[model samples]
Target: MIQRSTRFGHLLRSFRDAPSSSSSKIGGYLLASTASSPLKQACVSTNRDDEFANLDWDNLGFGMVPTDYMYIMKCSKGESFEHGQLSNFGNIELSPASGVLNYGQGAYEGTKAYKKEDGRLLLFRPDQNAIRLKNSAERMCMPSPSIDQFVDALKQTVLANKRWVPPPGKGSLYIRPLIMGSGEILGLGAAPEYTFLIYVSPVGNYFKEGLAPLNLYVEEEFDRASRGGTGGVKSITNYAPGLKALTRAKNRGFSDVLYLDSTNKKNLEEVSSCNIFVVKGNAISTPATNGTILAGITRKSIIDIARDHGYQVEEGTITVDELIHADEVFCTGTAVGVAPVGSITYQGTRMEFKTGAQTVSQQLYFTLEAIKKGLIEDKKGWIVEIDQ
Candidate 1:
C-alpha cells in the first residue's frame, strides 16, 4: 500500500473507511466540504481493500474520469491563496458573466502521477508546473497559489484519488491545475475574484495510435500564436484558436497540425499542443521560446537528457526546409510524452523521419519513462515521492 504522511494519513483513511451515507471529514486543514448536491456525491469506495479503479487499464484513453475528490482554493484579484480544500468530485458553479466564460481569463497546467510497482506514487517535476502556472496566472491577470501550496495540494489530491492511479506500465493519473477568473465580470477587464482548482484522470496515450509514429500536417495559413500574445503561457484562450486548423488536419487523415511562425510563415513553431524537435545526426534543434512557443517541461527535460547523453542540442530558428531535411523529428509534452513524427505533409510535399526502438527519440523516451517510474536512479531530483 502507498504510505501516507503522518500528518494527513488518518484524515485520508477516514475518507476511505467512512460509510457512503456518513459524512466524511477530509481533514481540518483541508476544510472538507460536505455540501449536499447532486454532483457533489462522494465517489470513494468504503472498502479499504479496493486499491485500484475497476476498469480495463489496457484500454484507458486521454479523457476525464470523475475521481474521488478535487482540490480547490480561491482568492481575490490581488490576494494570495491561503488555504484549499478537497471536495467531492463534482461540477462547479460559475457565473454566466464570469471572466473565464466571457473574456477567457484563465490558465491551466498539466502534470502526471505515476504508480510504481511497490504501491508508491510519484510526481515528475511538479515544481516546474507550479512555476509555469504562476507565470501563466500573472500573464492572465489573476492570483495563484504559492509553490509550496501548489505542490501540497497536488500530493493531497493524488493520495485521495490513489485508487484511480493506473497500475505499473498501464498508464498514469493526469493532473490538471487550473486557475481562472471566476467572479462576475460584465466589463472588459479582470474579474474581482479568482479560483484555483485541480482535477485528475487516468489516461493511456494522448494519440489514438498509442506510441506509434504521428503523421502531422503543416498549417501555413493559420497561426497558433502571435509575437506578444498568451501563447508563451498556458492560457485557456490559446488552444481554441488552433482548433480550426487541428480539425481540418484531422479530417485530412493526419495525427495533428504543425504550425509555422506568423510573421515569416517559413519557420517551424510547434505542434498544436506540444513542442517539436528535429534531429539530424548527433545534433538536436527546437524552436526557441521567444514569446510565441510554450516552454514545455517535458521539452526542457528532454533537451537536458539529450545533452547529457553527448548530443549537441540547439534552440533557434528551424526553417521548414531544415525540418523537411532532418533525419528524425519528435514532439514532447505532458500528455504526448515523446512522440516521434513519421511524416510531415507541407503543401503537398511529404517528408519522412526515422523512428522505432533504435532511434534517438526512442532512447530519450525510454530514459524519461525510466526516471518517471523509478526504474532508474533520479539523479536530477525531478521525482517527488508522496510518502508517510
Candidate 2:
C-alpha cells in the first residue's frame, strides 16, 4: 500500500468508508445504462467469445481501438473525488466553453498493463503515475483522486476491459488517464467542475521500427517547453505545439524531434515525446529534470537498473557536442519503452551511433522487458498484479 498525506488520507478514508448520496446516484445511473444499452450487449457478447481470436495482436499499432468500458469520476470545485463508476466506452458530452477547450486546463498520463504467461495481469509503477497525476492536478487547480483511488480506478478499468488485453508477448494494454476542467466556464479561470477518466487500448510498439534505432532531427527553431512551465508535468497543451516541428522532421525522414533548452539552446532538454540518454564508454548520462523536462518513470527505473548493472549513471546537463560524440544513445518512455538512437542531424551535420546487438540499450531493453513479463524476479516490486 502507498502512503498518503495526513489530510488527504483522512479525507479519502472518509469518502471511501462512508458512501455519499451522490456516489449512490452515479452508481445507479451507470448500472442502469450498462444493463440496457445495445453497445453494452455487444461488449458482453464479445467478452464471452474468444478475446484474442478476433484481434490481430501482432499487427496492432499505436492507435486507439475502442474497448469495452472506461472508468469515470467527477468532482465539484474545492472538493475531494468522492465517487467513480465503470461505463461503456463512448464519447463524452462536454460544454463548448469548457476550460480544457479554451484555456487548456487539463493533464493526462500514459502507462501500460502486461499480461503474464500464467494469465496474470500486471501494472508497472502505477503508483508513480498516480503521484504525477496528483501533482499535475494541483498545478491545474483541479481536484485529483487520492493515490489509492487512482490505482483502484485503474485496476477497475483494466479488469472491465480485460478481454482487450493482448497475449503474453504480442502486445500490451495502453492505459490513458485524463483529468480536465469540464464545467461550463467562459472566463479565463478554473472550471467549476472536473472530470477524471481512464481508457485502455491494445497496442504494439509505439514506433513503427519496433526496437530498431530511430533517426532524430535536432530542433533549434521551436522549444517544447520553457523554464517555469508545465513541461515537467504531462499537460495536454505541451503536445500540440510541437506537431509543426514534428511534421517537418517526419517529412525529412526523421522519427522524432530532439529539443534543446529554450534559454541556452545548447544543452539537450529532451525528445519530443521521450526522455533521452547517452552512453559514452562506461558512463551513462541524461538531461536533468529542471522544470523543463518531464521526469519519466521509465527513465528513473533505467537509471537504477543501470547502476545495479555496474554502470555509472549521471543526471546532469548533456551538450549536443557530447551527444553527437557519444558511443550510444537511446530514449525511454511508457509508449516508446526503450529504443536506440541510430543517428541525429543538427545544423546539416549528421552523427551516427552504434546500435543493434550487444549495445547497452539492447541489454537494458531486454532486462526491463523480461522483468515486466515476469520472466525474472521483480526485486523492486514494480509489478502490481490485478486480481482475477
Candidate 3:
C-alpha cells in the first residue's frame, strides 16, 4: 500500500509543476488551463477476497467513514481543468489564507452510487449535479469543472472504492464533489487558485427515523435563504448558517426544520437540507425555485414520477397554511431521498398529515429505488452505469 504521506507529496509536486498559459475570465475570476500531466490512476486494485466481509451493510447510517480513494485536480489563476488523479484518502494540507477558509468561496455537490444485484454500479442524474455545481461556482465567483470532467471523476472515484459500495437492497455509496478556491488570498475578493475534489462514503439513511415519517418544526424565527442570496445554489457557505435552527428543531424532538420564504415569511420555501412537497387528493405541488430555494435533482425526478402516475403536479408558491392542510407531505433530496413528513408545528399549533404505504411519497420512493437498483427498466435514461 502507498503511504499516505508519500502520496500527498506526489500530489504537491504535480500541482507545483502544473501549466499556466491561456486564461479567460468568468464571474470575475481568471479561468486557466488545467495541469499538463495525464490523469493518474489513484485507485489501487483491491483484493476481492476480504473486501465485503467486515462491513455491516444493513445497519449503515449517513456518516463519513473513509474509503479507499478520492479524486483531486487543481487550476491556477488562468487555466481550465486539464487532468485529475485518484489519490489515497487522507488529510489535505491547506494554507491558512485559503479562500475557502477565509471567505467561504466554494461549492459542493451530493449524489450517490448504488450497487446492482449483478455487481454493476449506477449513478442517478449526475449531469444535473454537474450543471448545478457550475451554477454554484459561478455564483460564488469560483471556477468549476465541466460536466464531462465531473461525471468522469465520479465514475473513477466510485470504481476505485468499489469495495465500499453497499450490496444491493442495503445502502449506497454517497459521492461528494467539492470545488473551492484553494489559492491563498488575504484580500476580500476571489482567490487566485482553485481545487476540485470528489470523495465517497457508504451510507444508509440520512435521518435517524430511517424510512418512517418525519416530524418537522416550522421555523418562524429563522430564515434559510434571502431572495438575493446563495440559497438557489449548492454553495458550501449556505449550509453552516442554518445549523443553529436545525439544532434547535432537532432538540425539540423534530426530524428537521421547515423554512419559509425570507421575504414573505408565509410562502413555504423548503426544509434545511431537502425540498418540500405537498399532496392534496390527486394533485401535488412544490415550491418553485425562485432564486431562494435549491433546485433538487431528486425533487425534479419525483415531480416527473408523480406526473407519470397521472397526478397533477404544480410548481408554484405554497403557503405554510396550505402545507399544513395537505393530505400528505414529504421531503426530497440526495441525502434524504424521499421522506414523508408526518406533522409540522408552528407557534405551538401542530398539524398532522397522512403517511404510510399508500401515500404518494412511499410510491415514488419505491419506484425510484427500484429503478436505481436495476429492478425496473430505466425509462427516463436517468441511470448512468459504471463498469467495475
Across 136-200, the per-residue lDDT of candidate 2 in tens digits comes to 88888888988878887888788777778999999999999999998889978999989899999
* TM-score of each prediction: 0.89, 0.89, 0.91
lDDT of each: 0.87, 0.84, 0.85
**TM-score of structure candidate 2:** 0.89
Local lDDT at 26 for model 2? 24
Stretches of candidate 3 off by over 4 Å are 1-7, 15-53
Predict model 3's lDDT versus the native.
0.85
Clashes within 3 Å, all models in order: 1, 0, 8
Write one digit per residue (lDDT tens) for candidate 1, span 193-291.
888899999999999999999999999889999999988999999998899999999998999999999999999999999999999999999999999
**Which candidate wins on TM-score?**
3
Ranking by TM-score: 3, 1, 2
The sequence of per-residue lDDT tens digits that candidate 3 reaches over residues 1-388 is 2223655657656544655443332212222444442442233353444445368888999999888778788888668876666666877766788899999999999999998877888999999999999999999988888888888889888887788999888899999999999889997989998999999999999999998899999998889999789999998989999999999999889999999988888999989999999999999999999899999999999999999999999999998888656999999999999999999998798899999978889999999888877889999999999864
Worst lDDT window (10 residues) for model 2?
Answer: 35-44
